[model samples]
Structures are given as C-alpha cells and as structure tokens.
Target: MLKKVLIANRGEIACRIVRTGHRLGVATVAVYSDADRDALHVRLAGEAVHIGPSPAVESYLRSDRIIDAALRSGADAIHPGYGFLSENPDFAGAVAAAGLRFIGPPATAIRAMGLKDAAKALMEKAGVPVVPGYHGADQDPDFLLGEAGRIGFPVLVKARAGGGGKGMRRVETAAAFKEALASARREALAAFGDASCLIEKYIAHPRHIEIQVFGDDHGNVVHLFERDCSAQRRHQKVIEEAPAPGMPEAMRLAMGEAAVKAAQAIGYSGAGTIEFIADASEGLKADRFWFMEMNTRLQVEHPVTEAITGVDLVEWQLRVASGEPLPKRQEELSIDGWAFEARLYAEDAERGFLPATGMLAHLDLPDDLARVDSGVRAGDRISPYYDPMIAKIITHGPDRTAALSRLSDALAQVRAAGVTTNAAFLRRLTIQPDFAEGRPDTGLIDRHLTELTMVHAAPPEVAALAALSFSGTLAARKTNDPWALLSGFRLWSGASDFILLEHRGQPLPVSFLSKGEGNYRVLLEGRDVDLRISSSPDAFRVEVDGRTSTLHEVHDGKATTVFRDGESWHFTLADPLAGEDEAAAAGDRIVAPIPGLVKLLHVAPGAAVSRGEALAVMEAMKMELALPAPRDGRIAEVLVSQGEQVLEGAVLLTLEVEDG
Candidate 1:
C-alpha cells in the first residue's frame, strides 16, 4: 500500500479520505485554500499544505500547485477526491509523469470519458446501451437547433464536460430551445471552460440509478450493486439509497455486468460510478435504462454503498493504486442490508434552497443510530466560496423501512443553529407518505414543494419555553438591585407579568399570572393556559396543558433557537419599547436577495419588461438563480453588469413603473 497519500480536495470528501488512510496506516496530507485554513479536513490530516487563495480557480483547480504541495509534503500518491482536479486528464498525467501515483484511473481512461459527447460514443462502441442523443461535433446553433427538432420537443441540453447539473437544462418546447441552448452554453463555459453541448430526449419519469464499479491493475474489475438517487432538486440529488427499493435480481445483475464492462473496456481502475437514467414510468427493467455518464472518482453517496455492502471504497482506491488486484470478485460481493443517505446542507429550503453562510455557534448530530460524515466543527464558518454541504447522514437497517425510520429520527435530533439549514426540510421529506413508501421520482420534491417548504412557527408550548429562558436574562440584568431581587416574584394574585416574543416574523404577546415557584397561568391570544417550567444546563423541560416536553435551546443574545421533535424554531424577544415602522412601498427597484456574481443581464436601460420576466441571472453557492422583474416596468438604470459580484440587498436595476 502507498505509505503517504495527499488528498487534493476539501470538505467532507477530504476528511473521508483521511479517515480511510488512517485506518490503513497510511499517513495523509491535506491541501487547503485561504478560506479553508481552519476547515475540519485540514485538522484531520497528518500533514497540511497551503495552496492558494479562496477562489477555486486560484487554488483547488491549480494542478501545478497541487503537484508541488504533494511533492513538498512527501506524499507518494495523490487522491483527487471527486471534484476539483479529480476528472482532469492533464492533472492525472502530470502526477504520473512526476513519479507519483494518481489514486484513480489512467489518464487515457479519464480522457476517454471526460466529455459526455465522446463518452456516449465510446459507450455505444463498447456495446453498452446509451441514451438516444446527438453527440456530434457540430457546434453551429442552427445545426444544433435542427438536431433538437429531430430529437423531438421536451429534450435536454447538457454540457459535454463537468457534472453537478451546472450546464444542464430541460427544453419543453421548440420556442424555448434557442434561449435554453444559449443559457446552457454560458453555464458550461463558466463551469467547465467548454461551450460544447449535446441534446438528448428528456425522460418523463426518470429515476437516477448508478452502479459502483472498481478495478485493479491486474485486469480484474467488479461491481458493487447500485444506488437509487431519484429524489432531486434542480438536477442536484437530495437523498439517495442503496439496493434500490424495488430492484429485481435479474435487472440488478444486468446493470452490474454492463457497468463492469464499461470500466474494463477502457482498462479503468480504482473507484468509479456509471450513472444511468431509468424510465420508471413503467418499472425498473433491464431494457428501460440507458447510460448517462460515468463519474471518474469516488461519489458523495458512497457511504450508503459502504453501509450496505460492507466495503470501504476509499480503501479499495488505495489498494488498487498500490498495484493490488480486486479485493472481491463480482460473485463474492453481496448486499447485507438497506441504507439511506440524506445530504444536510447549510441552506434555506424556504428561500428556493439558496445557500446560507454563517458561524456555526452550535452544532449537534445524532451518533447512536446513524453515521455523520462531516467536515465542519461547531465554530466553523460556512463560506460562500465553497459548497455549503454540512454533512451526509447515513443510516443502515435490516430493510428500507427500518433504515428510513432511523434516518427520520436522526434528522429530528439534529440541532444546528446560528445558520439556516435544510434539516427540517429533510425530516419532512423522509416522513412524507410517498417517500416513506419508496414511490418517488426526480419530480417528487418539486411536486410536493409547497408542503415540504412550509415553515411551522413556534407552538404555544415552545413560546412559553422561550419566555422562561428570556426571564432568566431579565433576572441576570437585575443582579445588582436588591429591590428587584426576584424577577419572577409576585406578591398578589392575578398580577400578570407581560413579555413579548417574535416567531417567524410575527409579534406574539405573552402574559402570565405568576403563582411563584416557576409556576404560572399563561395567557396567549386571550387563551389561558397552565404551565410549569424547569431548566437545566443541557435542556429545558416545560409542562404545557399537563403535557411535559423537553427541548434543546441555543441562544445568541438576539435570537433563541429551540429544537424539538426533529425541527428547529428560532424566536427573538420583541421589545415593547421598539416602534413599528410603516411597510416599505413597492418601488421600481430590483435588489439581490443574496450575494452572488451576475452571470447575465437580459435587458439594457430603457428596455421594457413585463412582470415576472427574467431580468438577470446570478450565480452563487455553485447554483444559478434568475432575478425576475417584480412588476411591468421600463429599465431606467443597471447598477451591476455581467461577471460583477454584488452583496445581499445591493440594488441591481432601477425601473420606471409603467403608467396605467
């Protein structure tokens, strides 16, 4: 085995590689950008090296800098963990030429599958069933439009290079093809430096199923079953599972065989995944699936595969890189149980899943029933320069039911504060009736989005708990006054203590007739309720209407975030002395809701735009969001142009409201 290995990546994937290296007694080296200097992966590795600035182009994507760091740190092998330079053929060849082992496939294989158009052609030659698409070299917009017409309406325009839904779009009609193609090409160019694209027939009910394939230098390759990643949003996977819920043995065997063939055809080695889009409008069958593309490195969802197959994929990568044969043949590999993985991201699901950035003042996760693969600590900052993935929570059980149940429980117990997260949304998705029954497709999230993103404000019991917590603060403020020694003390009956709090931006007034000893008859919205409160350093126990419940609380002076039953509620104390201001009148101004780089501006000054028309496109957190016209107006001023970075609430355009 390689003695020392360098991980050329950041975040959880880097930490994951370091873990396997440590278990195998191989010292690990980590490379970090300026933003990740205090990142968790840096602290986990045995050796660390500084590469460049925070921008990925200056640091993580700098192949020369990565090679220099590997050599300086005495790393014998380099493991490009999934992103950055993982699939770059030039980087792989450079590492090999430098007398260092690249813990991935040969550079030739990477080049063969680097472009989707070329990879699809290669797969067809290898007798692997590929999706019906136009993979030619013609780049003329007019020619591409002709190809799209031939393929049929409701087609897909995808970037030939790179993944992660960066440059993929679904064109629903012929009229939208021209604009969609331009958008896709722009995104592709920004993301992969390639403006090439391919057109394919869009699958109406697609289920993303992929087989994990690994090979060794000794001409041995095997498959590790499959993972179902049907639940997605904007082409990004939200949840994934192994041993697909309703997979049959015959189809499973066929997919495994085809994936192995694809790997062996290119003399591929190390861990890779062959992703297929299955037409599940019927059911999963051997003939209903077609090859999409191959991920030339370890996947983010590999943990679920590990949980089911009892295989450490990273260890396999290392073993293969060390010139070893396949550890297990296809016949020997077996699925043990079912597993589920939920990607926990630092994002607000209610805000169109926009990524969030903040200091993690408090972080709590379940450890008993699930495995949390994370790269951020309690004090870590979720930076906008990188992906906002907080962790991957994986659960295993004897069957899908048990695994999903455990996953729901684990999500509920998560207590992450000081930043908005999708934890609550994930919990809701797990327990949704259709999701619990394993009947979901790529459209499941979007179909049930309204209900899934519904925010549940603090209940009366939770509000009482927040009130009690705030009372403690009031008591602390009077520590120097003997006259106000007892903040909760009441001398007469029916003497109400008034307090105000806000939940989900709504003011709530709470009044309680204190009877002393932490007991009170609280009145909220004119309804009287009896309550008892007890607090400890770890948790708060509140008895509401004769029912007792315990909650974990984190207060940052301004707001108190309470977690209960797998969801979090943030409450802020409303000051009675504060005056209410009139609502801002709707104006002819468009401001950015979040900080992002403007990718495109659809209009110039004096251009007339209709309501809900796309005005500009902004890219942030590796995702693209379009800013639309708030009302029908004519553009009067454009503050930010393409490729310019703007902060949150920065006005991008000023418009003159159209007269009636």
Candidate 2:
C-alpha cells in the first residue's frame, strides 16, 4: 500500500481522494492555486502545497510545480483527480521520469487514446463499431463539406483534441455546414489549441451509455457495467445513472466487450471510461452502439459506478500504481443495485443555466440515502475562476425508481445561499413523469425545456416562512412600539406584516401575520399561507404541511436582510417600505450578469435601435448570452468596449429612450 499519495488536482475530487486515502491509512497531500488556498480540499488534506497563481493554466496544469510539490511532500505516488492534467500523456511520462508513480495508465496508452480522430480509427481497426464519419486529415473546408454530404445531412462536427462538446456542432443542412464548421473550428482552437475536427453521423435521439473499464499492469481488465447519461443540457451531462435503465442484456454484454477491447487495443491500465452513443430511437440494441470517445482518467461521475459495483476505484488506482495485479476478475464483478447522480450547479437554469457566483451565506443538505460530494461550504464564494459545479448528489437503492425518489427528496432539502443555483431545477427533473418512467434520451431536456426548467418558485407557505424568518428584523426596529411588529387577533384577530424581496430581478412584496407568538401566516400575491416556526436564537425551522424550510439570520446593523433557505433562497428587507426607489439610474448603467470576457459589441454611439435588438455578447461560464436593447431607443452612448472586463450588471451600451 502506498504511504503517501499526492492528489494532482483540487476541489471536491481532492477531498474525495483524501477520504479514501485516510481509510486505507495512506497519507494524502494536496496542491492548490492561490484561488484555492481557502478551498475545502486544501483543509482536508494531510499535507498541503501552494502550486502557483489563481489561473489554472499557470497552476494546476503546471506539471513541474506538481512534481516538485509531490517530491517536497515526500508523497510516494500521484493521483490525477480528473480534469486538469489527468489525461496528459507528457505529464504521465514526466511523473515516471521524476521517479513518482502516476496512478493512471502508461504514457503509451494515453497517447493512443488522446486524439479523437486517431482513437476512432484505432477502434475501427480493432473491430469495434465506430460511427460512420470522415476522420481524414484534409483541412480544406470544401472537402469536409463534401464529406458531410456523403455522410448525409445532420453530421456532428467534433473537436479532434477535446471533449465536453466544447468544439462540437450538429449540422442539419448543407447550408448551415460551413458556418458551423468555421465556428466549431474557432471554438475548438480556443478551447483545445487544435482546430482539427472530425465529422460523424449524428444519431437522432441518442442515448449516451459508457462502460467503466478497470485495468492493471498485469495485462488484465474488466468492465464495471454501464451508465446512462442521456439527460443533458447543451451537450453536457447533467443526470447520470448506473445499470442503464431499460438496458437490454445482450446490448450490455456487447458494449462491455467492445469497451474492454478498445482499452486493450491501447494497452490501457488504471481507471478509464469508454463512451458509446447509441441510437435510442429503436431502444438499446447490441448492434446500434458506436464508439464515442475514451476518457483517460477518473470521471466526475465515477461515484455512480462505485455505488452499484460496491468497489472503491480510487483504492484500486492506488493498488495498481504500487505494482499490484488485478484485484478482481471479470466474472467476480457484478452490479447489485441502481444508482443516480445529479450534478448540482451554481447556475440560473431559468436564464439559460448561466453560471452564478456569490457567497454561500448558508448551506444545508440531508444525509438520508443521498450522498453529497462537494467542495464548497456555507460562507465560501463561488468564483468565476473555475467551473461552477457546486456538487454531485448521488443516491442508491434496490432499483431505479427508489434511487430517483431518494434523489428528489434530497434535492428538495438542499439549502444553498448567497448565489443562484439549479437546485429547484434538479428537483423538478427527478420527479418529471417521463424521467420517472425511464423514457429519457439525450434530447429529452431540449424537447421539454419549458416543462423541465419552469422554475419552482417558493410555495405560498414558504413565502410565509420567508416572512417570519425575517420578521425578527421588524421586532428589533419596533422595539419602542412592540405592537408594531406583533400581530394577533384584537387579542384574537390577526395583524398582517409586510415583507419585500426580489425574485428573478422582479420586486415582489409578500405579507404574513402572526397567528400567535413565533407562529405566522403569509399571503403571496393573493393567496394566504401558513407557517409553523420551530427555532432557537441561532437558527429557525419553519414547517408547512409536509415541506420544511430552515432559515438562518444575519444582522449587521443594517436594513437589508438575507433569508437563506437551502439552495433555493433570496434576500429580504427588514424594512420594505423604505426601499421603493433605490434603483440606479442615469450615469449608472447595466452590468454583466456574471464574470466573463466580453465577446461582441452590437451598437456604437448615436446608433438607433429598437427594443429587443441584439445589443452585445457577453461570454460567461462558457456560454454566450445576448444582451438585448432594454427599450426602443437610439444609442446615447456605448459604455464599454468589446473585450472589456465588466462586473455583473455593468452597462455595455446605454440607450436614450426615444420620444413618443
């Protein structure tokens, strides 16, 4: 067993690795950038080293800095905890050169599977089914266009060098091919430093099924079954589950064999996942699955595999790095139950799922059957310097239905504060009728986006709880006239207390009354709501019917109060009547919604435009959002230039409202 293992990454994965290392009596070392000094993973490690600055390119991706940190910490081996440098063959080679064991495959295997174009060709030669496409190296635009014509319309243009759908585009017609190809190539170059792309036939209503293959240095490998990652947004995996729902036995065996063979063809070892995109229009069939790509490191969704197989893949990685043989044989490995993993992102799902950032004023999660794998705690800031994935919520049970039920309950109980999150959206997805019935495909979210993302506003009763949670503020203000904040029936009647908050940037005022001491009644819009308070000075629990929400108060001798109730939360004003005219106007302008590079500017000074015309492009959180003209008007002035860094809501261009 390895005594000390250095985790070559940061965030929740680092914390996750430390836990398993501790369980096996192995010391864990953590490396962090300046941006992550206060991160949860750094505090959890047995030893720590600061690698470099905040930017990942200069820090986490620095192989030399990581190797030096490992040597200084006296770590016997290194675990590339997904992303960062996990699949970099040169980094693997350098680790071996520095006399440190890399807890992954040999450099040769990484090189073989590093490029998609080459990997697909290799899989084809190995007799594994590959999607029909043009993998040739001709970079002529017209040549590729002709290839697309031969492959039929609706071909997928994918970056040869990267994954995550970053440089991928789906073309439906020849007229859209050239523009898509150029855009895809540009994005591919920006993200992967390689503009080369491969065209593949697009599968309609595809189901993404991936096989988890584990190999050892002893030339042995076995499959840990498959995961169904059909639910997604913008081609990114959102919800993943093990032992794919409605999987045919014949298809499972065939996919497993193909995946294992692909791994063997590359002389792969350690933990790697082989992804296959299947045509689900006909349901999962043994012959319909085609090779997508191979991930050469531990995956973010690895927990689902562990949940069903009852195996600790991290421990297996450690054992294999120490020159051990396969721990288990193919026949010995089997799935026991169903498992689901829902990715909780700090994003506004209602607003194109734009990544959100703010301090986690309060965070809470239940631990019944759901397991939370996260890096941030309450009070931590969700920064734009990295990915906005807050956590992964995993649940397991005897079957898929049970796991899904567990997922829904757990998502509802998660209270995150200080930022907008997708908690409510995730909850809705779990309880979706089609999702509950195992009828989801990759296009499910897109097909029913309106239904899937209809934001679940706080219930009327929750609004009541929101009122009571902030009612304490009124008590402090009306100290002189205690009756001012107090509500009761003329000793038996009730008095209504008004509360104000901003939901989705719209000002909404709510009213609630004190039924009695500590108990309250709330009216939202025009509906009456009930609240049951069960709290002490430090915290309060408000229960309504069957749903319960916890509220934590923060008093800084001010008028603005934050009402934190799980990830689904908002701020409240201790005095709503006084904040009616605090809006910024004139010289003050609109700001960017989130931190990102300014991608495009649509107007200039003296330019006339109508309401809803494209204004500018602000690229944040990897997605581009168009800022539209707020009102029909002529441009008074352009406030910021393209490529300027502006804070959230900073005006890019100001418009002069036109005269009637």
In model 2, where do residues sit more than 4 Å from their true spots? 473-496, 512-571, 574-588, 597-646, 651-660
Model 2 per-residue lDDT at 574 = 35
Give the 10-residue window scoring lowest on summed lDDT in candidate 1.
578-587
Those runs of model 1 whose alpha carbons end farther than 4 Å from true positions after fitting are 139-153, 172-183, 473-485, 493-495, 574-592, 595-618, 627-660
TM-score of each: 0.90, 0.88
Model 1 agreement with the true structure over 1-660: per-residue lDDT tens digits: 899999999999999999999999999999999999999999999989999998788999999999999999899999999877999899999999999999999999999998999999999999899988899999898898888899888899999998888889999988899899999999899888999999999999899999999989999989999999999988789999998977888999889989998998899999999999999888788888899999888899999999999999998999999998988888888999899999999998977788887789899988887999999989898877788999999999999999999999999988988888999999999998988999878899999999999878677777766676676633333246755645655455444667788876688888766665557687788788887766665776778867888888887777788888887887888767755331222357888877778889999999999889999998778877888898887999999979898877889998884566
Q: How large an RMSD does model 2 have?
A: 4.1
Query: What TM-score would you give candidate 1 relative to the actual structure?
Result: 0.90
lDDT of the candidates, in the order given: 0.88, 0.82
